[model samples]
Target: MKRLIAWISDLRLAIGLLILIAIASGLGTLVPQQESAELYHRVYDAQPWLGLLNGNAILRLQLDHVYSSSWFLGLLAWLGLSLILCSWRRQWPALQAALRWIDYSSPRQLSKLNLAETLSCSDASQELQRLEDLLSQRGWQVQPHPDRLAARRGASGRVGPLLVHAGLVVLMVGAAWGALAGQRLERFLAPGNELELVNRRGETQLTVALEGFGIERDPAGRPEQFRSQLRLQPGDPNAAVPLPASTETISVNHPLRFQGMTVYQADWALAAIQVQLGQSPILELPLQSFPQLGDQVWGIVLPTRPDGSNPVLLALSSEQGPVTAYSAEAEILGTLVPGGGPAEIAGIPLRIAGVVPASGLLLKRDPGVPLVYAGFAIALAGGALSLIATRQLWAIAEPKQHKLHVAGLCNRNLAAFSRELPALLTELQQG
Candidate 1:
């Protein structure tokens, strides 16, 4: 049992686990997560990056949702346990040892340290007092003994490793919590549309109202940027009837943060278009993607007669362009530009009216985001603290022999400490 505990607490084991987790995270980034099974099948069947592994294999291994997978969560749990065990078995004890003073009976004991030096003095008692004063001035915690003195500097450096491990554990816990309970929602909403924020349990928490959506297009008629004007209400959907004063504008790279949720403008699409069919009512037809026709093109099929006969396909690539009318035989019938007069297509007059644009908003709520940010801050502070060298000095003053035996040790930056120690000892001996 002791051996098992030691193995689990080993630094090598922790490093290996961290490397494995990094590799798994990389793989997870490569694979899209939480997509529909049909999308996975269609994507993988078309371009199978991994040979002999299809969508079924991906689903079986839970690779589609890697962060939420049992194996990934288990890895996080194991790493957290390892950090706790390692801190308990090693860092805590080391910190305690660093904080406590270890009195050396003789200067010879201090001489055995990793980086040690000896200093001689003419008047042992007077020199020892001077050295103690100097050490105190330099922020060293001094412990006086009958014949000797033990002084330590940077004792707090020992706590760095502990904080580092603690921060790592906290970060892991935050990530796990986010994977388990965080919410993500992506929706295409038209201007003036409102939706209630719902959790995984389908409980409405808040209301999001879209005031306006606009798409900035390039000279080539391609969308360069998409922006959404939004208003957030505190209560449920019904409570937002009068609208709220809390409004925010979100663009492509910029997002709006409210409460614990973030709203990102992800994409844009053509929602619907108004069309008039020969003295008939102006029909608002919802457009659907027709990738087979052209890129970024949307189309709709409308019947010429009220009896639903002679269906014709109307396709448009952009809102600014001409809409091509196609006959039932896949032949071009006529073209009508936006706001242009009615054109004859299969003996029916058609006119292209206005187009409605929709904005794609991605909402995310991660309860653990604050914890994760805090953990990272603590880790950075600990890393900076670890850079400081913990140094200790022991001195034995033999007044009868008129000799002071001084020895010094440093855990890190020994060369600099070595030069500084001699200079300090020389100053004390001269005084």
Candidate 2:
């Protein structure tokens, strides 16, 4: 058990685990995740990298969902365990040692230090007292004994490592908790539509209304960003509403955080086309993607006759204007704008009412988000505090020899500590 504990708490083992976790995270970034099996097979199997890595290997390794993979989560868990053990076995004892004072008795003991010196003194006791007062003035914790004195500065550096370990462990636990119980849902909604938010009991607890959506475009007619206008209301509108409904707009990178859930505008799509034929009522025709023509090109088919004999395709690259009409032979007949002049299609006047756009909203709920934030704050604070150099000083006075022996060392920045030691001896001599 002792050996196992030692092995788990080994510093090298912890470092190795960190390196492995970093490499795995890098790989996860390089690989696309949560894609369909068909997409993976069609892409990876068509052109296998290195002639060995195919879709089969990717699926076998569970790289499609790297973060949720058993091996990846296991690595995080192992690293968290290592941090806990290291703090318990190594960092705690180191902190305790830093808090204690070590008295130097003889010249031999002072000579063993990296920085040691001897100074002539008339009254050793008076010099020791003055030195202790000087150290206290310099913000060092000074403890004077009958024959010796010790001073410590920046001892808080010792606690930094323990705080860092605790923060990391909390972070890992929070991540694991989020992964186990969090929820992510993506839904496309058009204006006047609503998405139902369900609870664990399969009851509708809330309703997210798609009030409106708009796409902001540059002067060149290219989309710069898209926003979704939404409202949150009670699932049953007739019930006495506890939460007030308010309209909000959310765009890419600017999400709406409300009631423990976050809503983001993720994507946009052309849902349908509204048209009117002569004296008939306005009709909405569903649009389909045309990847062969170009990206973001959507088209709809409408039959000229009542029996749906000959179909004419109306394709549009964007929602603004200029919808191109294509005949049965896939030849462009004419181009027209929505809500503009009527177009003659097979001798029947046709007018385009408008194009309907749908907004893709992504909602996420993570209970451990606050815990993760706290962990990050603690980790960053600890990392900054650890940079403080911990310095220790020891001195012993010999009235018979009329010499004061001083020694000091620093956990970091030893050269600066060495220079300070000489300056300290000079001050004692002057005193």
Top model by lDDT, which number?
2
Candidate 1 Cα deviation (angstroms), residue 55: 1.9
Error of 1 at 215 (Å): 1.8
Each candidate structure's TM-score, on Cα atoms with residue i matched to residue i, is: 0.89, 0.91
Candidate achieving the largest TM-score = 2
Worst lDDT window (10 residues) for model 2? Answer: 234-243
The segments of candidate 1 whose C-alpha lies over 4 angstroms from its true place after superposition are 198-203, 218-222, 236-245, 293-295, 303-312, 316-319, 322-337, 340-349
Model 1, 158-241: lDDT tens digits are: 889999988888888899899999988888888889989765577667788899998889888778998899988766445637
lDDT of 2 by residue, 318-378 (tens): 7877888889998887787988877888667888889999898988898878888888988
Would you give me the overall lDDT of model 1? 0.85
- Scored against the true structure, residue 117 in model 2 reaches a CA lDDT of 83
Alpha-carbon RMSD, candidate 1: 3.0
